[model samples]
Target: MIIEISAGAGSPSEQIRDRVTGLITTGALARGERLPSVRQLAADLQVAPGTVAKAYRSLEADGLVVSRPGSGTRVSDQASSVSPALARAARRLASTGREDGRDLEDVIRVLRAVW
Candidate 1:
């Protein structure tokens, strides 16, 4: 469970939400997998607990995760990852980017331009 925060990306909560969303969509976070508690993630990320909570709430609203009092937050069983073809393409792009010595921001910039 790794989540990196970028100061330039957006608000802390938005960055968390986006990263967690990517993890779930990329199948890095499996369905029914439990997430770190809000406090735990905040502590790990050195952000406010409210930031993590906001991100979790957004994920819940998007149907990517579910939370319960005692059960904590878990990836929603109904949540689905990207299509196989897309995943393969992403992997290829990532590999190519790495080989070309392109950083993540560079790759993302190219992707945005292409989009």
Candidate 2:
């Protein structure tokens, strides 16, 4: 799972929080998926370790990432699911991005693929 912390997009913490949350919400990162260490992710994104740690702390508080002693942080089971609106919006973007540009067929295709 890639966690990007864009400095200009939002408060560093909020950007980190949103990116991680979005991944979980979109199912790009599955339940129990291990996350990079704070030091590692911080170096990768060029953000301060405190920023990544803050985001990880926020995620843990939200019941999204669980940290175990000696083991890495993992995605919580709660992240395996998302709210209906977000799920729908993600499908809409993917379905609409096709060459047909979001016709009923696209919707049906998404429905079939999902359902």
- The candidate maximizing lDDT is 1
* Model 1 lDDT tens row, 7-107: 78699999999889989998889999999999999999999999999999999999999999999999999999997789889889989999999998999
Instruction: For model 1, state the Cα shift of residue 64 in Å.
Output: 0.3
User: What local distance difference test score does each model get?
Assistant: 0.95, 0.81
| Candidate 2 lDDT for residue 19 | 83
Q: After superposition, how far is residue 57 of candidate 2 from its true place, in Å?
A: 0.3
Candidate 2 lDDT by residue in tens digits, 19-53: 88888887778899998898898888888999889
Highest TM-score against the true fold, candidate: 1
C-alpha displacement of 9 in model 2, angstroms?
A: 1.6
**For residue 100, what is the lDDT in candidate 2?**
60
C-alpha lDDT of residue 113 in model 1? 98
Q: Ten residues in a row with the worst lDDT in model 1?
A: 83-92
Q: Flag regions of model 1 displaced more than 4 Å.
A: 83-85, 91-115
